[model samples]
Target chain A: MAETYPKETSNTVNRYKHQDPSIPVPVVLPMIGQIGHYPSDQQPHCYLHGYVSSRLMNLAASPPGIPLCVAATKLDGFVLTLTPNTHNYNYRSAILHGHGTVVDDESEKLWAMQLVTNSVVPARYEHTRVPPDNAEMASTRILKFRIESASGKVREGGPEDERKDRRREDVLAEVWTGVIPMYERLEEPVGGPYNRVGEVPGHVRRFVDGENARRWTYAVEAARKAAPIKRVKREDEG
Target chain B: MAETYPKETSNTVNRYKHQDPSIPVPVVLPMIGQIGHYPSDQQPHCYLHGYVSSRLMNLAASPPGIPLCVAATKLDGFVLTLTPNTHNYNYRSAILHGHGTVVDDESEKLWAMQLVTNSVVPARYEHTRVPPDNAEMASTRILKFRIESASGKVREGGPEDERKDRRREDVLAEVWTGVIPMYERLEEPVGGPYNRVGEVPGHVRRFVDGENARRWTYAVEAARKAAPIKRVKREDEG
Candidate 1:
């Protein structure tokens, strides 16, 4: 889970606000996050950057912090089966159960900021204006999440049909069962209004080309693989 | 909110258990969901299909259902700025607060089933084997979400830098700030081992080509647009 989004830093974080003891509900926030092990830390944890609601900000300021579930899901392909009920997705999902606290240490905060910035585009922090001013540092708030437990699941390969459906020649003849490869693709860079640089930087170009190629290969390869014999029991299964 | 994800159906749902009043944390599950209004109903609601943990299933079975939050996020592009703190992503996120109950009404359940199947690939339910048998229907479970409220946010356009950074000639010249367009791309479909059909059907081909074009256009257009004058106040703002 710690290395799930080393490059792609988008994930949804779930925070529960227990306002009433009798009833509890979760608040979901789409956020940018990166997992890294600080030089001085014993293990890796997650650093989350987002403007949480004021209520959640207060929750993070308290002792022991707020309990959170950080999740990242990547869709590889859509598996088309003989029946709609059996259709599934080839995907990878990672979830971490943790407690989040607001990072106050200047050094750790700055390092985490660099880690997150680079996570977006490799070495992007150094490419931009260096060492944020006091005002910038003061304004930024990062949540340091200490993960207690984590789990990940990966499902890949072609579509799977039930034995009964496989035996029916009529259904097989009519229905088109297969996998549609899908992935996040980075298009050519579009320079900003203030950009004075003659050409897209080397770092930016590399990231765009490299990610597109890697993602395409992964999705197509997954589509070509054999389906798992014992598929995870979905809600549609009796 | 009801019209959100009318075509692409992927959302993460957060469910919390109040087993212990002293401690509460959210459980996040990546699931397939779609929003639709049945002809018999006055308003639209979300229908979710997934194999939830047994505990969550039990919770949903109880009266009033289980309180939940369903969220969908789409990243349009990466916005690069002169400073690391100002860097952001052009994206859209939607969240719905609701209670999820298992759909028991047979007719409604069947309708919701078709709704969710087509959400994956347009008109997919009818293309495959028709009318699930009693066993298939008995095994499948669809969660009907009664929407209490919902909200959404969209961010777009080029990089935004602070006044000081914009004034710095050296910083402006050095940093190649811009928007790198990003979007999910669907590649050519690959048939499964047991697929008897020779060519990718019209429905599957249309979905792949149509979606790729639509997503690509949206991302590039978003990158060329003007940034919001007063961006959402992020944690990095003092």
Candidate 2:
């Protein structure tokens, strides 16, 4: 039989539409089995994961779950305006609300560990050793959060100066107003002291270079208010 | 007459001694006046500032003030172990607990704005227009938080695998274990469409390059267990 999962509510979709889908956004859901039925009579809860040492886990374990908020921001550019007050930044940021709790299931822990590891560098799981040893597994901990709500906010394009500033001849002539694109870049990998491999592994190199290029292009295009070009057009085509 | 401020306890100093001083770590302190003396009737609080529209501020302003935890992580390296379970990351992460509120004072708001701007890029405040106009000032908002507690955690150097894995003769010969240093790099600045300037200003250029270099050096040195060289040593003296 095919497996089934809960569908996303329109509320959730509208809320996170502005967020970069590549980044993981925690959500709350009911636990269900492969047969598409609820695993038990228990109510739905938030399932989130983080490192064993995460402070979020510690806070959650204490008495009632800790009311927590997580915010991540990606700076696209520095927006310069003719007037200092009108200066702004082109950015994309998300806020998540949740209550943290530790996960004790071994299998669930392993799965979450793999999920997070691969999230940092895709395909990283297959390249390394399989299932962790008893001690290794014991050392790792998982945090399950109860997510309540989340939202994403974004500001893009050039500066938005006041009408007076834009219309003033002196201000318009003397000041340059626009955006200076900014994005994170990953440098070429440097081999470790004990690395016997002569070349940086293909996966590592690809992740570093690919992520940098993707982010750079996104920031520049967003600042310019240009839609991302997915394919190169042929010169002969209209 | 001399003014005095509350001093950091020895316990706090010992706890944060290992943290990199360059990064801002949030702290909870009593509300104080221009002389740095705690106001007689006011209680202790968390003081933080971000761009006017920061979600952090909005969340903090709601009702009883959200029980907020702020976390920041600086990835030093990716630790590759012989086994997947043993693989880890060398990093420094800090968590702060606080309750947020808005600061309505115009002078205080401007000061915080300048402080945050300079923190992003040194000397940036002086390079930009001096005091903000009335409309500009009115648009900006500052958040003051009531901080409860904070702590930082750091992991550095190479990977640590299980004893059995390390002792296995075959595994020792076939597997590589070490740290691949990672850091955030700032790329060359892209000028705005309306920028008439022929070249990027010296301060902006210096900030992008200098910050990148500093972070790169710090991550690599931490992974290698080497003390950072503060300045170039004379060849003759060495």
Candidate 3:
């Protein structure tokens, strides 16, 4: 079943909507690349996976009305050089900003807490006991910060900085420079219902195949490079 | 022969000097920690290691400098829950403000690039070939930004959101809530000066040992835990 809400436009980020009841504005779709997913309805509560450290929350809240916003930036690459000053890096990130509030209402609180868990790992809520009734859960202060706005920035490239060191090209230091691309995979659901049956679903099949395909392609490429006669090796190996 | 400068007490970070220009900045005694060294040598310079992106340099430059600066933050840990939104993460980063400059002086430019390299991998400068040339290095719009003011922030902790959470402690989904610490090592120095005959230097040895020790200690503990049972099994087999 699906319930449709108005798609987030530019306006939502500019203005605060659910301030009083303090409902945590859901996380905007994550910055997932080609195969990554903003998986739908993974848990009973339709919530996205995210959490802010209590300390950061408190620090970000120091400005009174202005909430602490977090922006996660990842350095994907480095542009190196002959001169010391020229080196730089390329990166990606998630920016989360808003005045978060503590989950208080029993029902909404239950959902928020459960959603935090399930959003991170689908169905984790089911594996454990319900949260609110427990004393440990009752004691910790989890505030629901109303997300105000956020944006993403990414960059990838080679030693574009070497232009100034024109003469240094032929002398290109032997420092290794290239992408050893990182792959992200959420392994087959372990210890959950799938583990008991010892069967993974078709949906999970893609995640597995994608990983293997990536590995196999790399392996084949390595073999081809190693072969004495490249084309001859290809035929012999095939 | 050795040249010694009078030790300045007031500004510890700025006073420390690199005794050897050949060693990577990180390996040079004074450059070890977060503190820096940029004393007034015959030619004055600054100890610049980590900071913001190149845009920072432009922010502080030329005609009517821009009042605003950009920031880059990173969230490293991914807290995957049953839900999608809570798949959070932990991380480390630097957000800086101010204008950076392009070093024009040949000597200054050379050392600046060296500092950046050492910042990335300690002792990387000596192991790696010397900086290329102006053209190759020029591609990196290396702007030297004088950090008039800046700060670094770090966060660490388990999912405390569970405090306000409703779930009980023991059964609290039994979700993994701890750090997956990040460790990195420089590949055993390959093609270096004395690459064939030399054993790793004491400094490099100390560096690897410090981090690798942490990693292997856990393995040793794990092996110990299973040793008795393994011994008994071997005897039975015999």
Indicate which candidate wins on lDDT: 1
Report the C-alpha lDDT of model 2 over B171-238, residue by residue, as the tens digit. Answer: 65555556667676655555554445556677777877888788888777766752221221111100
lDDT of 3 by residue, A1-238 (tens): 0001111223312222323222122122222211121233232212222333443334334442223233344343233333344444434444333343444456665555555554443455665434435564554444444433333444443333333334344434433322222222222332221112234433334544564465434323322221112110000000
What is every candidate's C-alpha DockQ against the true complex, given to 2 decimals? 0.43, 0.14, 0.06
Model 2 misplaced stretches (Cα beyond 4 Å): A1-70, A98-101, A146-148, A172-176, A226-238, B1-47, B50-70, B97-101, B145-149, B173-176, B226-238
RMSD of 3: 17.9
Better of 2 and 3 by DockQ: 2
The 10-residue segment with the lowest total lDDT in model 1 chain B:
B1-10
* Model 1 lDDT per residue over A91-202, tens place: 9877776678888899999999999999989989999998999998998899999876566678889998899999999999999999999999999889888889889999
lDDT of 3: 0.34
- Two-way lDDT contest, 1 vs 2, winner: 1
In angstroms, the error of model 3 at A227 is 25
From the highest TM-score down, the ranking of the candidates is: 1, 2, 3
DockQ (C-alpha) of model 2? 0.14
The candidates, ranked best first by DockQ, are 1, 2, 3
- Give lDDT tens digits, candidate 3, residues B168-221: 444334443322222222123222221122354454455546645654343233
lDDT of candidates 1 onward, in order: 0.79, 0.52, 0.34
Candidate 1: where is the Cα deviation over 4 Å? Answer: A1-22, A229-238, B1-21, B229-238
